[model samples]
Target: MKIQSASALFRVAGMAALLGLTVGCAPQTQLLSSSSVDRPITLGLSAADFEQAAAAATQSMLESGAVERNDGKKHIMVVSSVLNDTMQRIDTDQLVKKIRVELLRSGKVMVTTAIGLNGAEDQMNTAFSELSQSRKVDRSTLVKQKLAAPNMSLSGKILQRNNRVDGNKELVEYYFQMTLSDLQNGLAVWEGEEQISKLGSAKGTSW
Candidate 1:
C-alpha cells in the first residue's frame, strides 16, 4: 500500500510540473494601449490613426462654432460620401463613426443614418414607408411626421502620398480632409484636415 501511494504521488507531481512547464512556455498575449501605442514602421493605416484623425477633425469642427444651432434645436446632419483616395483598402466609416458618436453625445447634432450619399444606412425606414403605403395608412401620421430634412451635410476624403526616402526607408503621408456644408445654402460651414506621416522600410506593401 505504501509503495502504491508513493507511485501515485510521483505521478501527480510529474503531471503538475508538466502543466507548469506548458503554461510557462505558452506565449503571453497582451492588450496594447488603444489610445496611444508604439506603431510599427509600416505605411498601413491603423485604428489609432483613424481615432486620432477623427478626434482632431471633430474638435476643429466643434470649436469653429460651425455646428451651432441657431434655433436651440439639435441640428439634423447627414453623412455624405467620404472618398477614399488612398492606395490601401479601408472603410471610411471607421473614422466617421467616431466623429458621429462624439457629435451625438454633445447633443448638438443628430446624424441621420436613414439617409446617406450611398443610400440609406438603415433600410428599415424605407421598408416601413413601403409597408405603410401598401396598407393605406394615414400618410400624414407616419410619413410627414417622421420625415425631416437635414440642415447640414458632412463630406470628406482620405488621401495618401508615398515618397521614397532612401534605399531602405520610405515616407508615407495620409490626409484626412472633411467639410461640413450647409444643405440650404450649399456653403461649407466648416473645413478641417488632419495629416499623419510614417517613415518605414520600403520592403512590403502599405495595404
Candidate 2:
C-alpha cells in the first residue's frame, strides 16, 4: 500500500471541510408543523395551541350536525366577530384558518370570504360589485352573481385566566370558545369550548 503525502492529505481535508460548510450553510425549506413533534409552551398563544383549539372546535361542530343546511347542500358559513379577549395581540384568523380548512375538507361547510364582520374578506370582490353598479349592469344578473348570502355564521372569543401557583410559579388558562349560529333563525346551533393551561415561572409575562 502507498501512503499519501501530508500536503495532499491537508488539501483533501480542506476540500471536505469546505463541502461540509457549503451543505451545512445551505438554507432549509420551511414547512408547516406535523403532529409528531412536541410543541413548545410559552406565554402567548402558539401555533400548536391554535391548531389544537381549531381541531377541537371543528370536531365538535361536525359531530353536532348543526352545520347541515336546510337546502340539503353544504352550508355557506360566514366568519364573524371572533373577538380577542386575551391580552396577547393575535389575528383571530390564526385559529379560524385551520378550522375553515378542515371544514372545507370535510365537505360539510364553505366559508364565504365575500362577507365578514369587518366588511368582506376580499376587498376586490367588494370593489367589483361597486364597479358593476357604476357601469349600470342589470340588477337581476348582478344580484344573482354578486350576492350569495351566508346561511350560517361562526363567531367566538378567546379568554385568559391566570392564578399564582406559588411564589415563583403561575398557572395560565386559555379558553377557546366558538359558536355556529343559524342566520335565518337567529339561534346558535353549535357551541364548543377548549381549554389549554400552562404552568410557568411568574418572573416573566405571558402576554
Candidate 3:
C-alpha cells in the first residue's frame, strides 16, 4: 500500500510538472508599465505622408521627360534592385510596384517583365512564350521582329539614421534614393532623394 501511494504521488507530481512546462511554453503578451506607455511618439507626417511621397516621386520621374529623351520612342523599362536601409522593416517593392503601375498607366513606358532580377518576370514570360509557341506565323518571320529591349533600368537604395537625445526620446531619419539609369550608356541620367524623419520614444511602448 505504501508503494502504491508513493507511485500515485509521483504521477501527480509528474502531471503537475508537465502542466507547468506547458504553461511556460505558451505565448505571452506583455503589459507595458504606465511610464513606458505614457512616452511621447510623433511622426512628421502620417501614413499619408509616405504614400504621397512615393506617388509624387514616381510622378516627377515619369513626367520629367527623362524616359522620352532616352528612348525617343516610348520604351520598355525594367525596375531593378532597390536596397532598404531603414530601421523599420518595409517591403521596398510596394514603392516599386506603385511606380511601375503608374508608369504603365501614363502610357509613357512599358515595363518588360521578361527581364527581371530572377531571369524573367513570371507571368509576362509565361504569356509571351505561350503566344509565341501557339502562333501560326512562320517562326523565321517572328524571329526577325525582335523582342523589344529595355531602354532604361530603375534602381536605388533607402538609407536610415537614428539619434537619441536622452534616455527617453529618439529621432529616426530615413532617406529614399532612386536612380533612372540609361541602359544603353550604363549611366544614371536621373537621380532623386527624399528624406523623412520621425521622433518617438525608444521603447516603442507608444506610437
lDDT tens digits by residue: candidate 3, 1-207: 999999999999999999999999999976654452444335333344455557777777866768674445686798899987765566787777777888888787899877778777666555655656765756665442245689899898878787786888877777778899899899987787788777787765212
Candidate 1 local lDDT, 65-136, one digit each (tens): 998868899889999989999999899999999999999988899988688766778988677767665657
Q: Write down the lDDT of every candidate, Cα atoms only.
A: 0.88, 0.87, 0.73
For model 2, residues 103-200, the per-residue Cα lDDT tens digits are 99999888888887789898877777675656576655655345679999999999999889868898889999999889999999999999999899
Clashing pairs in 1: none
Better of 1 and 3 by lDDT: 1
RMSD of 2: 6.6
Would you estimate the TM-scores of all the predictions?
0.79, 0.76, 0.64
CA deviation > 4 Å runs, candidate 3: 1-50, 69-72, 124-146, 205-207
Better of 2 and 3 by TM-score: 2
Candidate 2 clashing pairs? none
Q: How big is the positional error of residue 198 in model 3, measured in Å on the Cα after superposition?
A: 0.8
**Lowest-sum lDDT 10-residue window in model 3:** 36-45
